[model samples]
Target: MDRNAKFIAALKRLQGVAPIQVWPATVKSIQGTNCTVDILNTDLIDVDEVNLRADDEATEGVLIVPRVGSLVYVGAVENAVDNLFVCQVSEVDRVEVKIGNSLVTIDKDQVKAVRDKCELTLSDKATLKQDQTTIELSSGKVKINNSATSLKSVLDDLTSLLQNFTVTCAAPGSPSAPFPATITQVTQLSTKINQLLS
Candidate 1:
């Protein structure tokens, strides 16, 4: 089987929720007919909760899929476990993809998808780097791991994927806004008292 074909078969064999939500990502390696991608899905919030979790080869694993006419790549990084590339799937085999109306065949040149459920771990700090596979496809958004901030988020990128939100009160002696007591008579009295101290 070809690199694209093997990955496509992997994709087609996939079933259940085990398929990691795959978005296009950097390519890693392509030996023989098997192509690889360094994929990440930002929509997948619980990296720790969801993984292939498959101990046996016969068990189900996550799969990666790209829309038809999409381009994908894998493995070309220097000394890196995975690199990157860009290949447009020229001929799409038929298969049913949950995201779209069409399903791809198990083998074809444009087989821009993979079937693999992965378990990714994190460090003491929030940052994480894990290895996963996918076929070459472009979504105007791509990440090696979607657990953190990427280009897709334009609005300050709010979420655990990139940040952990924290709220703190101002310290004592911190500056305070001057009160315009004229809006209310009670406020005016308080302002007068504060002014006396000034």
Candidate 2:
């Protein structure tokens, strides 16, 4: 009739004498790579120690950890409930991918990447765009658009010039000298700028 009914019928036909090896379940709790779930059947049955299936196999692949209260499809091998594992999930709490020495992880709040070395060689251009701002790398040069430059070297030069600012005056002491508290104010501003930017 429907997709689920058709799928179950197909499984029944294929398995013949064996019990259905797949069913929908709701995640109840998680313990490492294993989870506890309430199998959705005529009667709710709580199954424990179910493994979460991921492509990970030591060296490389992806792993997705399901969140509690998420709907998942639980599958078993050879109709054995003891071999139960989550084959699919409707929601995820975390996802991680690994390849050789590189790793990328994504969670609710942030995405992190770790690698030994990363290199990008583009024939034409490589651009990183976010919102309305863009950074482009082309022909061994970097260009930033719609964003203020916060380069430390440029800021340092401006800070140095401000610290050494002076005006020529014919009056008393020194013909060329900065205003009394200009160096202190400039130094404080430079510190704040460095704290706020790169």
Question: Which candidate gets the maximum lDDT versus the true structure?
Answer: 2
Q: Which stretches of candidate 1 lie over 4 Å from their true place?
A: 1-19, 40-198
Angstrom error at residue 20, model 2: 6.5
What is the TM-score of each predicted model, taking all chains together?
Answer: 0.15, 0.53
Write down the lDDT that model 1 would get: 0.33
> What digit string (tens of lDDT, one per residue) describes model 2 on residues 106-191?
77865656565442223356655544445567788776544444344446657677667766576777566556566665666676
Model 1 TM-score on a 0 to 1 scale: 0.15
Point out where model 2 deviates above 4 Å: 1-20, 42-44, 54-59, 117-157, 162-198
Give lDDT per model, in order. Answer: 0.33, 0.71
- In Å, residue 92's CA in model 1 sits off its true spot by 10
Could you give me the TM-score of model 2 versus the true structure?
A: 0.53
Candidate 1 on 72-187: residue-level lDDT in tens?
43222232332222333323332222223222233333332223342222222222223332212235433332323232232333232125333343677776442333224444
Among all windows of ten consecutive residues in candidate 2, which has the lowest summed lDDT? Answer: 114-123
